[model samples]
Target: MHVPDGFINAPVSAVAGVVAAGAVAVSLKGARRELNERTAPLAGLVAAFIFAVQMLNFPVAAGTSGHLLGGALAAILVGPFTGILCISVVLLMQGILFADGGLTALGVNILDMGVVTSVVAYALFRGLVRVLPRTRRSMTAASFVAALISVPAAAVAFTLMYWIGGTTDIPIGKVFTAMVGVHVLIGIGEAAITALTVGAVVAVRPDLVYGARGLTAPLKLRIDGELVDAPAPAPAREPAAAHRSTKGLWATGLVTALVLAGFVSYYASANPDGLEKVATDQGIDKKAKDHASKDSPLADYGVKDVSNARISGGLAGIIGVGATLVVGSGAFYVVSRRRTDDESVNSDSRRDEKV
Candidate 1:
């Protein structure tokens, strides 16, 4: 959920800022192990895809709507550390460029939407995959269940934050009940989106899906009437054709993201999302302040002075996708490069020692 300014008091908001900052710092270090030549670009695309899909809000209740939070989907596709960074990039873009989420409350939104959802969903997903059959179907199912719970988990997180720093005097019980209830309905939509996306990726390039990796059972050999694990296969050199295939997948994903944000987003539901609806209904937004970038050309997901709603929104969406891809890819590329540099340095050190 994109927590706007004035909802949480200054003290709690500052605390959340510190927590979010620390989490991002930790994720950056963890991502060094996750990002690589093939997966780094894919991670960027995942961020852009999540940014696009989030625009297509689906109706959850009569007046409430929900969109893909992308935590579960991202974590399933990439690693959890990278997933957190992906969502953070999207949130940062939306807050600064689109004026969708408040700048002052950026930390709160990142903590709830990025940190809590990704961490909780990935942990649950790992646990479920361990228990369930090790198959693509099981992975997709795990994604569904993980996504289903992540939304409510985020709602609970928000409720706790509000309890501590809510600007209004609304009863804590009412806020929690309403937030969790509506988000439960919203979670179904999240689950469906996550499952379908994860399934699609697993079908095409299971190697690219971090959660799907190692799902296939290890080979076993029966010798002397006893079964034992087979010798691990040596690493093979990647062929040019395989590299071409990765490029093809990346092209396809970028095209899909463009289509979703540029064209399909026009048909998305116009109703307020789960958090907005709950805030309005429960008076949690009584003191909500205007977004700092409300006057930006691309504020509110529309181009300034653009009379055609369709064209304005479409341009904004395209811009957002492009910006997110550039920034995200740049960030991930740096992390991947650092990893490679570290390996090279270690190799040199070892070589020198042998000399």
Candidate 2:
């Protein structure tokens, strides 16, 4: 959930900012090991796709709506550290450019939406996948459950934060119940989206999905009409062909994201999301302040002086997708490059020692 300004006291909000900063720093280091040649570029597309899907808010309860938080989906497709960075980038972009989340409360949004959701969901996903069968179906099932829990976990996190630094007088119990209740319903949507997306990606490009790596069952060969476990051999392929396949998948994903954000987003629900609804109903939003970038040209996900609603929103969405892709890709490339550099140095040192 995007916590707008003034919902939390300055002291608590500052503390959250420190926590968020630390988390991002840690993730950057962790991502060096997770992001590689195959997955580094896709990280940007993952962020852009999350941004697009988030625009298509689905109705959950009576008037509240929900959208993909993308933590579970990102963690499953990429890696947990990179997934955290992906969602963080989206939150940062939304806060600064779209005036969607509050600039002052960026830390709260990052902590709740980025850190809590990614960490909890990935941990749960790994646990379930380990216990369950290592198949695509089991992977999808684990994704569903992980995504289902992550939303409420984030809701609870927000409740705890509000209890500490809430700007208005309200019963914490009531706020918790309402926030959790609505978010549970929202979680269903999240789970379905995460499962379907993960399933689709795994079906086409299982090698590219980080969670699916090394998940294939041992091959059983029919020897003399009896099935026997066969030693697995590494598959060989042309580098150019593999590169082409990755490019195709990337292009297709980017196009789909563009369509969703640039055109389909215009038809999304106008009602408040789960967090916003709960805040409004529970008096948590009484002290909410205007976004710092409310005067930006693209504030509120619309271009300045653009009278046409569809065009303005569409342009803003496209611009957002482009910016997020560039920033996310750049960050990932730098991390991946550093990893390559480290490997090279180690390789050279070992060679010199052998000499």
Candidate 3:
């Protein structure tokens, strides 16, 4: 949910800003280990895909709708650290470019949506994968459960934040109950989207899905009438055909994102999302302030002076997807480059020691 400005007080919002910044810093470091030649660009594509899918809000209740939070899907497709970055990039773009999320409440949105969802979902996903059968089906199931829980977890986090710094005097209990209740329905939507997306990726390129990695059981051999693990295969250089396949996958993913955002988004539900519904019902928006970029050309996911609703929204969505891809890819590229540089330095140091 995109928390608008003035929902949280200055002090609590500032503290949340600090916490979000620290989390982003930590994720940047952790992402160095997750991003590389094969996965870095895929991570960027995941961000763009998440941005696109989020535009297609599905009806959850009578008037409330829900969209992909992308935490579980991203974490399953990429890694948790990079997943956090992906969501953060989307949030940042929405705030500054689309005026969808408030600038003042950026930290709150990032903490509630990006950090909490990714961390909780990834941890639960790992646990479930360990317990369930190691198969693509199991990965998809784990993704569903993880995403189902992550939405409510984010709702709980926002409730706690409101309890501490809510501008209105609405009873915390009512807010929590309404928030959790509506979001529980929203979580079902989240779970379905996550499961389908994860399953599709696992089917096409299991190697690209971080959570699907290592699910394949090692080969077994019978020697001297005793079962034994076969020797692990040595790492082999990626063949040119595999490289072409990866390129094909990337092209396909980008095209899919473009289609989803550019055209399909026009038919998405127009109802308010889970958080907006809850806020309006509970008087949480009594003190909500206007977004600073409300006058931006692309504000409210529409182009300025564009009479055609379909065209305006379509252009905005396309712009958002493109901007997110560029910024996300650049960020991941830097992280991946840093990792390569570190490895080169370490190798050099070891060689000098031997000399």
lDDT string for model 2 (205-307, tens) is: 6677776556546423344776555433325656777778789989999999999999999998888999899988988999999999999898988999999
Quote the lDDT for 173 in model 2. Answer: 98
The candidate 1 region of ten consecutive residues with least summed lDDT is 227-236
Clashes of 3: 0
TM-scores vs. true structure, each candidate: 0.94, 0.94, 0.94
Question: What is residue 175's positional error in candidate 3, in angstroms?
Answer: 0.5
Number of clashing pairs per prediction, in order: 0, 0, 0
Model 2 spans > 4 angstroms off:
214-237
Over 303-355, each residue of candidate 1 has an lDDT whose tens digit, in order, gives 99999999999999999999999999999999999999999999999999999
The Cα local distance difference test for each model comes to 0.89, 0.88, 0.88
Weakest ten-residue segment in model 2 by summed lDDT: 227-236
Model 3 worst lDDT run, 10 consecutive residues: 227-236
lDDT of 3 by residue, 1-355 (tens): 8899989998999999999999999999999988897778889999999999999999988988989888888887889899999999999999999998888898999899999999999999988987876556677889999999999999999999999999999999999999999899989999998999888776666667787556456323445776555443223674676778778889999999999999999999999998899889989999999999998999988999999999999999999999999999998999999999999999999999999
Measured on C-alpha atoms, candidate 3 has an lDDT of: 0.88
